[model samples]
Target: MATATGKNAKKTNKQTDTAGTKSSQKDGGSYQAKDIEVLEGLEAVRRRPAMYIGTTDARGLHHLLWEIVDNSVDEFLAGETDRINCTLHKDGSSITVSDNGRGIPVDKHPKTKKSALELILTTLHAGGKFSDKNYARSGGLHGVGSSVVNALSTEMIATVRRDGHEWMQSYKRGQPTAGVKQVRRIRGHGTTIFFRPDDSIFRRTKFNPETIRQHLEDISFIHGGLKIFFHDETKGETHELHHPEGIGAYLEKITTDGQKKSVHEIPFSTEKDDRGNRIEVVLHWTEATDEEVRSYVNGIRTHAGGTHESGLRTGVAKAVKNYMDVHDIKAKGVTVTNDDIREGIVTIISVFLGDPMFQGQTKEKLNNPELSGQVEGLIRPGWKRGSTPTRRLPTRSSAGSCSPPALAWPA
Candidate 1:
């Protein structure tokens, strides 16, 4: 949170080396090529875990869980799976994620000459999601922490069911404990992974089932077609989250959970799916002084408002302007800016696109420049025509859904 100063902020001067290569001199100190230490494979992740997962705290520990679950969610995005299972063991420190989808490839990698499954677990930036050939849209952009998670975990076990056979592999702190072995012949396809976060790396080792369930529930609302089951052995409780109502249902839950009173009865929502790309938005005016906007890209929440959030606000503003223009309304000579239009706004936006640009490996912010415009384009028309001015404040809930030709406010 502090500004950079000192050595970290020092500018380097370029100098020619004995080999005619450029050498960097920081404040006239020796900074040669050999001074650079390269951390290979998952070593870098272990040395600087925060650089990959944001923190070595409880949140980052859960993030490791999200990394695995998100990969399964990617399979769902690819239309390869429908169900994802998350389990917390009695110890509350070990967990597992299972998905019924096309399993990770186990064949030898041409360049690395290692099994694809092993390569993906042991290396960084190695996975089927580098391009859209396997997944047109996925949430595991820079948070593809499979290798990072493996590096930070004290124990990890992977099981894959594909190619009409079952394969298994075990690892401890990113290194394989045994070679990948074919366990048995299997009929279906899917993947299962179990891991325990390293006590030395993470400040917190135990996990909260409530926290995990809330996340799974939120994810269910984002990807409405997918089913997520959370089993908390610690409490002997299981929760199933499958919200086909999508973001619309989520808006209601948000309002109720926060006890926020809404100026509108039924939230205005719109969703459009073109091939694999999809966008869903639900918004309402609230009595709250500040605005609340929950946004996501490919089902991963963007806590830091990004371009897409800006687009949602812009789109809302544009719609309000269009409505006033069509109705010949004015603000009594007062300069009613976009801020006025969104003063008490409550909104949720979810988008799934082929290629997403995130701010960092944490994937907490999306930086896709085109998303601002694309989201605005989609939302502008939907908003202008989605609602009509009511004579009175809206009351009584009407049918709310995110799927559509667009939505209208309750009369």
Candidate 2:
């Protein structure tokens, strides 16, 4: 086709585009700043809960619960407290999470003039986790977890056991009903949040005991030192999940539950503190034909996977290769691949970082570019350390010639 070139082409296209825009605007009406809508208070979260909690279905309903629990867990991680108790009320729609940690401050906010507890429960992007002063590594980024829950909840009550006495405040749809009230004299410190998910927003407001129990179990596995108690008033039962054995025990439980036998008598696992971040991993070879990995960033599950998983896979492959080279083990006519090395391997990787970049408000994936390298660095060295006198990889030798040593369980 014949066409204009260079400067003439640019001029022609620009004129045509500008003229078309003017014509369209004249017909459709002009755009105006008035068209924009600024959602105030917690209305933005209420208007579109999915943007923050992923979905308005059953999962999102539980996300509201998770946000509060995670805040308490953050306290535990900060070495502020230990015990966390979660109660599902008989009404089925209400829940109460109590933690024996340094409670939310009840002092007047220097800027807002609102009580710290009230401000935290009523505002978005307002929390102590914004800096390392309160929490070294917290799952609460954007500082909206508690407030979002309050916004979505029909009623929320925040009880703080600080300032020498217990302070109680109530909120309705993210607005404080009244000023902080001083409850009867009480000792110690912590926070208790009671909330009911707004029925108008969620398809189902009833909290599933099984779903919550499973989640608590998984969290207990991750934070081995933290004690979690679940009181299911639905069944009048109380269950406690405390596994000081940590992820090592978690791996064993998962494999056992899956009916998969481990190739190693003892799985390879590591728990190391790098500065403020804690890196944890537990894994072993199995009889399965494929691999499965579960990764988490800052106590929040990363279901979509991310740089951490990439680092894990790379470090694992490198460790295998390094071990082969160090031992002078080789197969003359065979080739080893990363997939082969990882086959039938199931692993759980949990990392805690001071600042983690989440993919979205849902925090379903981790996006930090440096995290992968950090994870890999830890994994490689961890594998070497695990290869001590009592722990060794499988050795192989075939009659005709050595086949690529099928990575079996460690002996």
Local distance difference test, per candidate? 0.82, 0.84
Clashes of 2: 1
Highest lDDT model number: 2
Q: TM-scores of the models, in the given order?
A: 0.85, 0.86
Model 1 residue pairs with clashes: none
* Runs of candidate 1 exceeding 4 Å displacement: 1-35, 142-144, 273-277, 386-411
Worst 10 residues of 2 by lDDT: 388-397
* Candidate with the greatest TM-score versus the true structure: 2
lDDT of 2: 0.84
Tens-digit lDDT string for candidate 1 (17-133): 422342234333576688999887788889999998899888998999988999999999899999999999999999999999999999999998999999999888888777778
List candidate 2 segments past 4 Å from native.
1-24, 27-31, 325-334, 382-411
